[model samples]
Target: MRSGTAPPVPSAPARRLLLTAAEWAVLVAEWPGALPPGLSVEVPGSRQRNDAVAALVARGVLRAPVGGPVEPVPAVAADLAVLRRPLLTVRLETGGRGGRRHGWFALGADVVVVVLTLPDGGIELSLAPAAGLGAELARVVPEAAAVTGPTARGGAPPTGALPLGLLDAAPAGRGGPPPTAAEAALAGELLRRTAGSLDCLVLGRAGGPVGAGQVSWLATDGGWVGLRPHPGGSPRRVVDVVSVRPADLGTWVAPTVAALLEGRA
Candidate 1:
């Protein structure tokens, strides 16, 4: 299966950590059988670097399902547990997977369903109300219009956390400014450029093999989604890692996003 986006470099603060010698031995590429009695390794630098290392030991390169019905499969039990109540779940076909309903899973909840064709990857989440929500439907916020609003074209700009509704908007009606997690952090100018409903979630360093790979934007490059295998012993063992860069970025991304002028989504 395809792989997800990788994490970023950890902070550079010199430090020391103690690990068992056997663990250290795992670092040895030459497959040294074992460590001698009474031994340990003192590792210096950030432990964040070893996140991939630990994941490899826990679950090696995950392989894609070789042959399974392309038809829909149930979401994982763990995944289901996390998705409860008012918090509805919707899947989008970031890649060319699934049918028209492919991205929209049938969860049946009081939620606005959105099918976002993100950069390279797709995410199915909520954009419902967190208490008092906008009664309005989705609309494409034109570049000029976003600024013309009463907030004034040259205002302080949006800061702090955006409303839950604004971030997870449904891709219909007049879609709002579809901001990527990246855009939300950046000044509104970056967001003003795009006018589409596709967004990216900046999930720090992708926890490799921890769950499925995570999806992230790569600035100039498109987006990528991580996919890991469901557990099964080999013959069944798939490739350890797979990375699928979306065929094209910005194929999505257009006039849906509006430049925020402080205190707005």
Candidate 2:
């Protein structure tokens, strides 16, 4: 690939690259931020590792020619971009002396994922089902009902307005166990199905305290989405307001990120 050339976002399941643990290590070493955590990649010797890199390049999962630097193609970076494509998006905001906190959400047909930004410059990912999530959100913000709906047949994906406390809650209770294996699988499937399309909810970088309430998103058709806020009433200190909207995210994904890299700066 050329210096400024961007790779495409993989949408088809066939575009998913299945690699050995050794290959994954090589790819991660070349592009540090292009893979999710948990896999243990341990390979021996520079010769074998180099061989794996060459094989990945040959397979079109990466782009590296001779002396060129190894570059991750869509097969490596598409997961990050695809995860950001949701069926419906909801912006959750709360403020107090502890400083302002924001929760950015992407709702899919089966999964409700949230990326929360804390005052301490930390972020967290949470996952839940639409039905269970709606029940929880209503506890914090009664007007959260407007955000969630039947997502089948072009209907809007489920959306919600709730405090981070309620959202971070596990099935056991608030601040309990993280998502189980089953939940994680569902979340992964949701991302895979929504990749490279705008029919789902799309989330973008969350604004700061001094910024506007609504977050913006770019659609695949060269237009903007999420400009219109979903109808709802203000609740209270927990969830003052919520905005559920749409946007096409796959059209703008750069093929080197495994996760949303915006707002980190």
Local accuracy of candidate 1 as per-residue lDDT tens digits, 83-169: 322122223222111111122221222333222222233222223322111111122111222222232233332323232333234
**Model 2, poorest ten-residue lDDT window?**
218-227
lDDT score of residue 190 within candidate 2: 32
**After TM-score superposition, what is the CA distance of residue 137 in candidate 1 from its true location, in Å?**
28
Error of 1 at 153 (Å): 20
TM-score of 1: 0.16
| RMSD over all Cα atoms, model 2 | 17.8
Q: How accurate is candidate 1 locally (lDDT)?
A: 0.27
